[model samples]
Target: MKGLYLALAALLVAVNCEAKEPPTQVVYRFDDHRSLELKGWDCDGELWYTDTQKGIHSQVWSQFYRIFTKKFIHPSERYMAISSWGGGFTVSKDYGKTWSGAHYSPGENEPNGDNRPPYDDILSFTVVGDQGFLQTKHRLYMSSKPFDDPRILPGGPGIHYELEDGVKGDIQSGSAGWAWGLIYMTRQGLKGTIQELQTSWKDLPDKTPEVKGYTGWDHMRCDMDLGK
Candidate 1:
């Protein structure tokens, strides 16, 4: 009886420790000497980046929503950007040396559209070339110069998409909002500040906007290696 009790205590201790462990994921890897990582789970987490070549390893952002937020990198151009749930963008022009963050107050009502319900959730967020976009249930927000701001482009109707299994579930409904591809299918049509997208829309063979850059973060993997 004594031995059994001891074994049960040990198991409980191990289980508790494991449960307390924070989840981590490698969100991006630019090269052998540079990378980004996300630590913690859900909305409570820190964003960290390491540039061995630049002798930098540190947290860039904190208390971010990991599930809905993401970072984008243009390695060759030394550009790094993040679309945040707090209603803005965080960008680093010189790799990780500098950062500019913009956001609307979470406590405040989000930007709403005509006759549309309040925008409270993020459906999708993406950055292509120099343009950035954030989609909610009823509103589509854009930023042409995401490096400076995430509200450059005009607001309009948000884009709707079917999940892999054709269900759009999320926090309010158990369906999560993952990264989405850029589609020009909106009420705004082919009108935007991003010249590439606007130009591409002009010659689109069909009325449907061509989906582009769906696997944008495929190359950005986050791996945690707390070295000894």
Candidate 2:
């Protein structure tokens, strides 16, 4: 009888230990020093960021629509952008120090009119230095500053283009050319045009952005511990 009691007590202890395990946080690490930690993803999806090198840790966002959000870091590592199909876009230019966000409606006309592609028509969004490259089906756009208010660049369909990495390529609906902190895409490949196109370009320093830490599109129920 004593052995049976001991066995039941041991089983209860094991169950208690399993129940006390802490929840795992979903973290998106841009590098060894910086990361975005998601605490919750319900109505007020709690979002936080940490810069271990800077000794800064703070909440970034907690909006209603976070279930569909995904984060992206520019090659310059200065601009960290987040996109949610339902919540719009948010960008940080000061290495997660401050943030600006706006919601974009697809198929809707912008202030510039119809020829200009909608902000949400992000077939491929790439950043090189301080410039932002956004490519649609027929045109390649450029933002002198980027992730904020990008303007259309001079170009059309039917020409291939060369990337900064020396890889001559055509327009693709998926990823674009991201090399040496520059991106290029076109239907008909052209060489040296990326440099020839005159714009007030700035040489933003490279910090080697990374995106391998993203877990998935939406946060699972287990990702956050709602209980006290």
**Count of clashes, each model:** 9, 9
Screening candidate 2 with a backbone cut-off below 3 angstroms (N, C-alpha, C), the clashing residue pairs are 159-187, 159-188, 159-189, 160-187, 160-188, 160-189, 160-190, 161-189, 171-186
Per-prediction TM-score: 0.43, 0.43
lDDT of 1 by residue, 50-98 (tens): 8888887766677654433333333332545565444355656566676
Clashing residue pairs, backbone N/CA/C < 3 A, model 1:
26-221, 26-222, 26-223, 27-220, 27-222, 28-220, 28-221, 169-175, 170-175
lDDT tens digits by residue: candidate 2, 72-144? 3345456555544453446566766776663322221233444345445545544445444545555554433
| Number of the predicted model whose TM-score against the real structure is largest | 1
> Model 2, stretches more than 4 Å misplaced?
1-24, 41-44, 65-73, 103-128, 131-142, 146-228
RMSD of each: 14.1, 14.4
Candidate 1 regions with alpha-carbon error over 4 angstroms = 1-24, 30-34, 41-44, 69-79, 84-87, 104-124, 128-131, 135-140, 144-228
lDDT measured at residue 43 in model 2 versus the true structure, 0 to 100: 25
